[model samples]
Target chain A: MATTETVAGAAGEASQKGMPQLNFATWPNQIFWLVVALVIIYIVLTKIAMPRIAAVLAERKGTIGNDLAAAEELKSKAKAAEKAYNAALEQARADATKIIAATKAAIQKDLDVAMAAADVQISAKAAESEKRIAEIRAGAVAAVSEVARDTAGALVEALGGHADASAIEAAVSERLKG
Target chain B: MTVADQGLVIDPMHQFQIVPLFGGDTLTWYTPTNQTLWLGIAVAVISLLMIVGSSSKAVIPGRTQSISELLYTFIHNMVEEVTGHEGAKFFPYLMVLFTFIVTSNLLGLIPGAFAPTSHIAVTAVLALMVFLTVTLVGFYNKGIGFLGMFWVSSAPLALRPILALIEIISYFVRPLSHSIRLGGNIMAGHAVMKVFAGFAGVMGIASIVPIAAIAAIYGLELLVAVVQAYVFTILTCVYLRDAVGEAHH
Candidate 1:
């Protein structure tokens, strides 16, 4: 209650003194200070602060733009590298195919040459065996004729009949011919 | 006055008083006052924040530099959005108004500080300047066709005159409403806090209520401080759009 009374008293005093803000006399002073302050602030902001901030912003923008451009350049470079890698991969495949084909042809030629040499040796061995067979057959025929002649003489002596060697040979030869 | 008497006196309005800084028998136009000192302080602080803070112009901004840059972009985008590309020409003006008003409002939140924006003289002058500039630009750019802003071509021909009259009256009332809106809001917030503070003295142990109320109001005033500055600047841009905007026809 005592606090309220003091508050009222203070309010009364303030009212009695008149609100300085409402007082027309001080309006010009306040207005003058306001204008001066605003003008000064305006000049400072426009001339100094704003320009500095703008420069910073522009610098940041410029840096960002340059970064983007650099990124674009790098992206293109990477793409080119990828394309080259693909081209190299294709070339490697093509080269491998050529090497495989060349190896196959060389092996085929060597196989053909080896097969021809083996055929010639087999034919030569067959021809030599045929000649030896012919020689053996001729020797067998002579031995057979001599044995017939000896057999005929022994038969004639045992029988006490005369037998001629030339006649015996002629008879055996004629039989052989027939 | 005795100490008891002084302690009991709850003069909440006393904070708003403009006493001269130097002892003077007569208050003159040139007399330095608390308003001057605080205004100077605001200017100095803004200079420190903007000029000194951004002196390095670092690509990576420091604390003060970041604040300055943020404030610059915020107002820059606002002006661009509100008034289109041409509004950039008035960007510095809007920036100045926003920083001054917001800084002044925030500074005024300090105990025993004066809010320049709370004064009718200050807000009125600022509003008047906006009104005058918008008007002059409208006239200069659009010539007599500026008057067509009041005429609603879309309205029925029979009601066109009435609509135009209303528009004219509302247009003229722009400065009045603009000034009162800012000044009244700031003044009312401060006055309410003062009343709450007065109650604090009388409420004794229950002074907690009044103290809490003051705290809440202070928080609200902080929001109001920034919002009022934004409101004032955006409104300026809206009015400027009328001046430099492209014609529909």
Candidate 2:
């Protein structure tokens, strides 16, 4: 409530001024004082207090508007900062996936190379074992030939004693030649 | 001259008095007449209440505070609403003038009291204050150069002074007329009431009829009290029309 206290106060002041003048002042005297009071009060209200009050109100309005503008700016800045952070997080996730795929590929390549080397070693070992078995079989056949010659010589000697060794030997030699 | 031959010697308006501290030779302070003392007391009491009602007040008002503020606001709005926005500044003078008159008038109704407004001197001073305040407001807002409220500024220069002189005289008379109008009206109303009461007594049992009539008239006086306060305030606003600028009227 915009109270006119100054006016009320002015009246109180005038009343006090009024008291001394009651005995001393006539109608004219009172009128003169009343004029003086009115002029002074009007000047004070118009020049001093009223202007100051209006200025204060105007200043307050400007301050509130400034505050609103500042708040709006801050709100936008926060939104932009949030957007940047989300973009960075998304980029980090993409990088992590790429690294994981590369690791998987590397592990698979190592396993494939190891399996190929093992297959070659097994094939070479099998070929070497087949050659060694052929060599052992040849040695065994030579031993059997020597034993047969010796047995034949013994039989001819025995047959000489029994009178048919020379004729058996001649028939075996002819069959061998044919 | 003791002319109490038939009936009452008692004059309520007279016979009561308050002694004064200081002496004076001219318009001097002596024991004030009963009416003056009562009126002065009414003034002091009313002024004190207005002070109490408005000082260091709360935003949400209490009962006494609200009534005081309402009276203040009601007068303020009445001025503004009557005279439009330009009249806003005149609230100070109009408010003061209204409170002083209305308070004094209402006080006069208190059986043993008198209204200072019943005196030509007090009301004339009040009216004079309004007249001066408005004129000063007008002149201040419009410099000494803008005295065109009189005759047509468009009129030939030879005619301006004669017309302007008349306008100035009429303007000066505002206070005298305004004060008397109020003082006369209120004084008549009270005197008539007393006169009728005197009539009722003489008329005996027929006095009941006059008593009823007086009662109705008292009711009318109360209404007039409020109306006169309003009339005084409205005229202040209308007179203050030029307080801002000529366009304001």
Candidate 3:
């Protein structure tokens, strides 16, 4: 066992005496490979991978920006459309009011013309009725005079006295005048 | 009993040895090693994730695509937050650094797999590259005023020179600490797990203790893997912020 241990210890010492990592000879090789690896990685990243990733990111940003801009534009357009619609609605209301006023005035003008014609007809009918009333009053006066003259003649005859026609007519006319 | 007493010798450091793939007696610089194999695998996996997974470019992403996109956005936001909007231009580099380091660290966690980050060689190169880039960018952008970062304008005139010297030393030490921090943490975590695994081999049914410890340490190492990657990236951003002269100080 002691001999085996000694042999094992000797072997371990032999292996551990000079670590290859500490050897100055192989550094250039490792460094050269390192630079090669770094250069290759740099090329891959800068030329191929990074640009592709940047493109994707840029595309996403651009899409978002465009969507936001379009939304803003649409919102403004909708607002303008609403404004124009409101303005048109206001104009329509004003036009309707003006039309209503004009129509009312036209109707009022027609009403005034009709009222004037009716007034003329009513005045003419009133004048004709007034003339008839005057004629009726004249007839009533003449009939009353005739009735009194006849009544006076009858009364005188019955009383055994003669009544002169011209004298009785004159007496009825004078009494009617009184 | 000692590990050797039970006829079991546990060499925790054995896993770090670099062996030639084709059974060559001596490893040349151009020889394909385990490091090369795993590094290739990591690169391929990353490529598969970032490229082929999103090949369809569906607006609604699948799982792999979602992961890639999440990593992209996460690192992108980090750069933006730490380095500001101007840092956007450097985002690809930051993305590459983050994905590579994180993927390498995670792949290393697999049992019997090699962690490239466990070696100082790989991490030092990464750190040195960042340090050099930041220094160059600072000088390029700020010109002579880049030295103003080291000069302590806020300090008393007598203390300014001493403070400036300290700042200069700290600035130069940045790469050393940056490289070692990641490599050390990863190496230590793996080494400790291996040590515990070695103990489990000799303990028979009582191996439950080391097994439980291994389980717990593995969970911690997994957290460390992501956290170290984050720390490394954020520090890079901070350095970048200074380089771009965006620091309020």
Give the per-residue lDDT of model 2 (tens digit) for B1-249.
122756743232321112222433222222233344554565455545555554435444567556666666687678777767887866766756676668778877777566666656667777877888877877887777446676557668898888778877977787877877887777767766776777676777888887888788888888888788778778878777756646421
lDDT of each: 0.84, 0.62, 0.84
lDDT of 2 by residue, A25-66 (tens): 234333343344345434443444334334444555677789
Query: Regarding TM-score, does 1 or 2 come out ahead?
Result: 1
The residue-by-residue lDDT of candidate 1 on B163-229, one tens digit each, is 9899889999999999999988888899889878887877689999999999999999999999999
Q: Fnat for model 1?
A: 0.54
Model 3, DockQ value? 0.18
Please provide, for model 3 over B108-187, each residue's C-alpha lDDT reduced to its tens digit, 9 standing for 90 to 100.
Answer: 99999999888899999999999999999999988989989988787898998999899999999999999999998988
**Residue pairs that clash (backbone atoms under 3 angstroms), model 2:** none
Error of 2 at A96 (Å): 39
Global local distance difference test of model 2: 0.62
Q: Individual DockQ of the candidates?
A: 0.26, 0.02, 0.18
At residue B206, candidate 3 shows an lDDT of: 99
